[model samples]
Each structure stands twice: as structure tokens, then as C-alpha cells.
Target: MHMDEYELEREASAPIDMLETYYRALGWEYERSGEDEIVSTFQGSWTQYELRSIWRAEDQVLQFLALPDIRVATEKRDAIYETIGLINEQLWLGHFELWSASGLVLFRHAALLEGEDGATLSLQQAETLVEAAIEECERFYPVFQFVLWADKTPQEAIAAALIETQGEA
Candidate 1:
């Protein structure tokens, strides 16, 4: 199924409790890891999808963007392309990596490293990758639900519902 169509379907059919169950079944191991970074894995008949959360610290932004080594600076172009190439290689291998550097405000799909130093990417590019990954996972897994709890925040659940609906449209 196409990604937009899947988003619409997900938005329409996913229920809150179901999403909760999906998260819960992963167990404490997953949740513990999520504290630092969220990681989710799904296995279908033919493919496996692994979602990893990427984080960057505030001080690291300049260094990350400039493609600088911890101690010294070098030609930015060379570093950027090299980084992008490595990331592209990983994507071809079917790994979905999401980067959240400088708080949750900036989200992007790490598409490719541009130079020798790895310059991270912007959110739009990241979303493109994420959409593809989600679609692939849904093809085989099929089942989805919104997992909500009384004590938990409603925002994530709401987002999940919307995502499900968006899948169908």
C-alpha cells in the first residue's frame, strides 16, 4: 500500500487501547531503552523494521553541522559527503534512523552523509525516510493500535490516532 493511503487508514482504524498494547507487548526492555532513545522493532513475514531515535546535544550542534572532529577542524565538504554516504548505505540495508538533535523541535530522517564529516539532516528529509519505513512495516504487520493510559499524556495518543487516519488518506 502507498504511504499516504496507509496513513489515512491508520488515522481511521487505530484505537487508543490497541496502540497501548502494541507498546506494552514490547515490555520493559523497550521502555527502558526509550528513556535515552526510542527503539522499536517489528518483524513481518519477509522484512524486519528497526526504528531508532537519534539525539544530539546542544553543544554538539555546531560541531555536528561543521563536520568537525572533537579536537580539530578539517575540510567540511569532505566530511559531510562521507557521512552521508555511510548513512545511505545503512538505509539501503533497511535501517530507519530518526535524529532529534537540539531538543524535539528539530526532527529529521538521516538520509545520507554529505561529506567526510557527517552533517546531520533536516526534518523533511527524515520524514520521507520514516514514511517509507512505516509503510514497509505495516505491509506485513497489519495490526496497529493507540496505546493510552489514564496517567499518561494524551498528546502522543492523539498523534498516533491522527497518524493512523493519515495512513488511510
Candidate 2:
């Protein structure tokens, strides 16, 4: 079930199409780089990110990735490695990691729609996963910055990032 053939089934738009439509409604620009993949950009307060998604129909998996422009300096890889454990502990959905080969740090999450009795992927599901990934990336962006640029210890970075919050009274 390749993405190209998935759209031909039932004469209706496929899951990938719905996913693209979801992004369109959010007013984000995207490009389909392959039959199963799309790339989009999102702007956060700290920086902009290139977000890529790949729909794997055979596996019934939709994977989303958000990559910031900064690279983990060769010397700083150890620091990021130490910090990721703490960051991942607090994350509910996805985890951040350094792509060792490229020295790139990226946030990744996936939605698995397999084996749920006749369940089909929907726009809502795609939007929910994507929104969560974006939010997760933004929330933890500062932690990476703390380690990569500010030379904060992993413990210090996590403690600072995990401070309790209060709502407006």
C-alpha cells in the first residue's frame, strides 16, 4: 500500500491527502517531496523549523519530524546526549535526539494506526499528532539551546526547563 496507490482506493483522497489538507487549513506552506513525504516549515519564538512527514501505508505509520537549523557542535554532542535523557523523561509523546551523522538535532513523533478494527486515518488524527509535535518541539527548544549555546549542565537545563507554572488568577 504505497502512498500513490492509497489515494486510488475508494476513489477518495488518501490519508496523505487529508494530512496535507490539514496543514493547508493551518495556513502553512508545504511541498510534497515524494509520493509519501511532505516538508513544511514552522516558526517558533526561538527559531524556525523544517518539519517533514512521511506516511507509511504498509506499516500504517505517520511519522513527523521537526528540525531546527542549529547543529550540535562536535564538542557539544556529549552535553546534548546527557541532556536528552532528562528532556525525554518529561515528554509525553516524542523525544529529541542528535542525528549523529549530520550533527543535527531533531524532534520526532509517530502516529500508528494499525490493528484498530477497520479504523482509518483521518484529518483530525493527523492534525492532532502534528499539533502535538509542534508544541512539544517549541516547549523543549529552549532546553537544547541551553545545552548547545549556553553551556548549561544537563541537570541545570532540565531543572530550569521543568519549573512549575501558574495560570492567571
| Top TM-score model | 2
In candidate 2, list every pair of residues with a backbone clash: none
- Per-candidate local distance difference test: 0.32, 0.75
What's every prediction's RMSD, in angstroms?
20.0, 5.7
lDDT per residue, candidate 2, 52-86, as tens digits?
A: 98888888787888887769888998999888887
Q: Residue 141's C-alpha lDDT in candidate 2?
A: 76
Candidate maximizing lDDT: 2
What would the per-residue lDDT of candidate 1 be over residues 62-118, giving only the tens digit for each residue? 111111111112323233233333334434424312122311111123333343343
lDDT of 2 at 103: 91
